[model samples]
Target: RLQRDQELTGVDVVVLDECHERHLDADTTAAFLWDVRQALRPELRLVAASATTDAEGWSRLLGGAPVVEAPGVSYPV
Candidate 1:
């Protein structure tokens, strides 16, 4: 999609929200998403957000890529 179509031409930054949704395991999805991103768009910044996942998996996928986490709101038990 990046070559035939300019899907990433004007994209300043790409935030891959809910990237883990694609995988049954959050960590597994992180690795998969990272590989997909690297294969598709290495320059575009990819971000992942989830209730049970964190930037560690993302780092592994991204080879120690930087991660900025925003504390998510939680409901009462």
Candidate 2:
């Protein structure tokens, strides 16, 4: 949707999952979202989620955003 230059309309948040993978498409999407947030929608909320991602690195890349860590979950095998 972003690459196609389509408007996000009523969407207020975007979640980028598996950011630790560092795939090209995901990177591009992240860049686009960052651009949109900076240039178009300053209020648009963006989230990058991964179990093992570099929280500080991503926070720096996202303009010094704060990092939130969640407790891991495990089930009996």
Candidate 3:
């Protein structure tokens, strides 16, 4: 959508799940979203989420965005 210069109408948030996997497509999408947020939509909310992701690194990459953690649930194996 971004490459075509189409506006992200009605889209308030974007969550990149499993960011720790570091796949090329995911990385590229994140990069593009970051660019969009920076250049076009400063109000756009972007979230990079993963249970084992580097929170600090992602936060820094997202221009000092805050890191929010959800409590984990324990389950017997």
Considering every candidate listed, which one attains the maximal lDDT? 3
User: What's the ranking of the predictions by TM-score, best on top?
Assistant: 3, 2, 1
Candidate 1, overall lDDT?
A: 0.60
* Count of residue pairs whose backbone atoms collide, per candidate: 0, 0, 0
Candidate-wise lDDT, in order: 0.60, 0.86, 0.88
Each candidate structure's TM-score, on Cα atoms with residue i matched to residue i, is 0.54, 0.85, 0.85
Candidate with the larger lDDT of 2 and 3: 3
Supply the global lDDT for candidate 3.
0.88
Poorest stretch of ten by lDDT in candidate 2: 1-10
Put down candidate 1 lDDT per residue, 10-65, tens digits, no spaces. 66554556665665565554455456556766776666655566568766766787
Error of 2 at 55 (Å): 0.5
Please write out the lDDT profile of model 3 over residues 3-62, one tens digit for every residue: 676347778999999999988899899988988888888999999899998999999999
Task: Give the Cα RMSD of candidate 2.
Answer: 1.9
Model 2 global lDDT (CA atoms, 0 to 1): 0.86
* lDDT digits (tens) for residues 1-77 of candidate 2: 77565356687889999899987888888988998988888888888899999999999988898899999788899
Off by over 4 Å in 3: 73-77
Per-candidate Cα RMSD to the true structure, in Å, reads 4.6, 1.9, 1.7
Colliding pairs, model 3? none
